[model samples]
Target: MLPNYFNTKPLADYMRHDLNIPADREAGSLSAGRVGRIAALAAASSAAYAATGHLLALLALLPAPAPAEEGDEDRRTFWTDLRRASGASALLPANLRIGVVAALDGHGAGLATRLLGAFGGMSTDQRVATALLVGEHLTNGDDFPGPASTTGELWLRDVELTAWQIIHHHRRPPTRQAREQFREAWNRL
Candidate 1:
């Protein structure tokens, strides 16, 4: 059976309020403005992670940046807004206890890691949620303009895979390879 937390309303409400999104914007509406789109995606991503502890649903919500933009600036803005919204929501006092995860990309992963790590007093669930968020963010290629380096991509894949194993596979521990790769990726960041 699905978990009750999968309801998504609370997550949507949290995003809308914390991100200062417009009241009329609906979380499920694709026609909304940029802020609304980001809010919707963040809410959906958070709910999907909390519900299934998997990254696919969250990844699928990412729309490719519109091609009409002249350069990478538009893509950068999209990722930046997404990272900002997710970071804000993740750090909220009320939402912190929900074990929220953010779907970050690129250097945003490093930023989220440092921010969450500095908290220093997070509960075990919070730590797990942060790790899962990092994994989900790293696994998403949409954040990158071009293909990521093979080694970096592989490391991210392992991180997400290990996180899933721990979250949904009866507490199976991360493999030695995954641990090593995660350390390497963290250091590179």
Candidate 2:
């Protein structure tokens, strides 16, 4: 069984406190606002991923729809309605997306912690999975922590950018190649 405190706090706590360098930014380090945003984004993304996974599983049980013919307006309308029903939003600005990714690249654990918080509470297994996914996707392989330059930040920035891109792309009917790429990227983490 998990501890009560662990279940109540967002998963991001693990990453921020234990993973990130300086962990809690002091006066000269990163600002409170930046850290807070990263934490919040991470938490939100994690929750969304979990919820979406459940939703897709339920959807899979239903009968498959017929393939749309070329330029089928009805197909387009159906997707439009479906997306509207899903209610996912494009929340992060592009610049911030880049910055967060950069942070993840340099500090995978820190990034994962922020994301774990965003994901909210989960089983120990779930938390670990979420952390691994975020860390792998965001940083690729980079994992050094220190003062962040724009160059260094850009490397990590790809993770956030990829997340956003995935969310947006998933809304549409992805091609086989696209789906394969997405799965491969995710499986790597």
Candidate 3:
């Protein structure tokens, strides 16, 4: 369980309003799909690597799509809607991945704590994941901490200027090549 301070309205509201997830998502044993996918991917890669990837996905996507599995079962609604909404192809995944990566970089946990409050109630990985995904910004580009920058862009800014140079900034879509590129770009960043 999180401390009372972490139970603030803003954080809870972000989960409910933005992610549409229960604030207790981390406190639970984790959803079967979230756990199974992370376990399998971790087994394939290293626990550190797979765990990191999973956390970032939790942070960025709208409803936080489960990682792409073999059958593409998890990829259906989230990715499809994102593609249709964003008009991206395979590059969507790449941008999201890069956006998350750039957002985290060295400031991973620190950034998450600042945006999410009290870090991850029980899960430390999410301390960074939520930051990379949802991110913080000056609301209306205000640059002040009060209201503006509430919707701030973290990795979005860095990645756009540096890697890929996406003009409109695409994010969402799951292709093997995009996965590889996302990983590669993350490494380069």
Residue-pair clashes per prediction, in order, are 0, 16, 12
Candidate with top TM-score is 3
Error of 1 at 57 (Å): 3.6
- Candidate 3 residue lDDT tens string, 31-62: 77755654454343232232233345434433
Candidate 2 has a TM-score of 0.19
Q: Rank the candidates by lDDT, best first.
A: 1, 2, 3
Measured with C-alpha atoms, the lDDT of residue 18 in candidate 1 is 51
Overall lDDT per candidate, in order of appearance: 0.42, 0.38, 0.38
Segments in model 2 whose C-alpha atoms lie over 4 Å from true places: 1-33, 68-189
In candidate 3, stretches whose alpha carbon ends up further than 4 angstroms from where it belongs are 1-61, 70-75, 106-189
Top model number, lDDT? 1
Who is ahead in TM-score, 2 or 3? Answer: 3
Q: Tens digits of per-residue lDDT for model 2 on 53-168?
A: 33333223222333456565644454343323322111112212442343323312333333323334344454344334333333443553433333223432443443343344
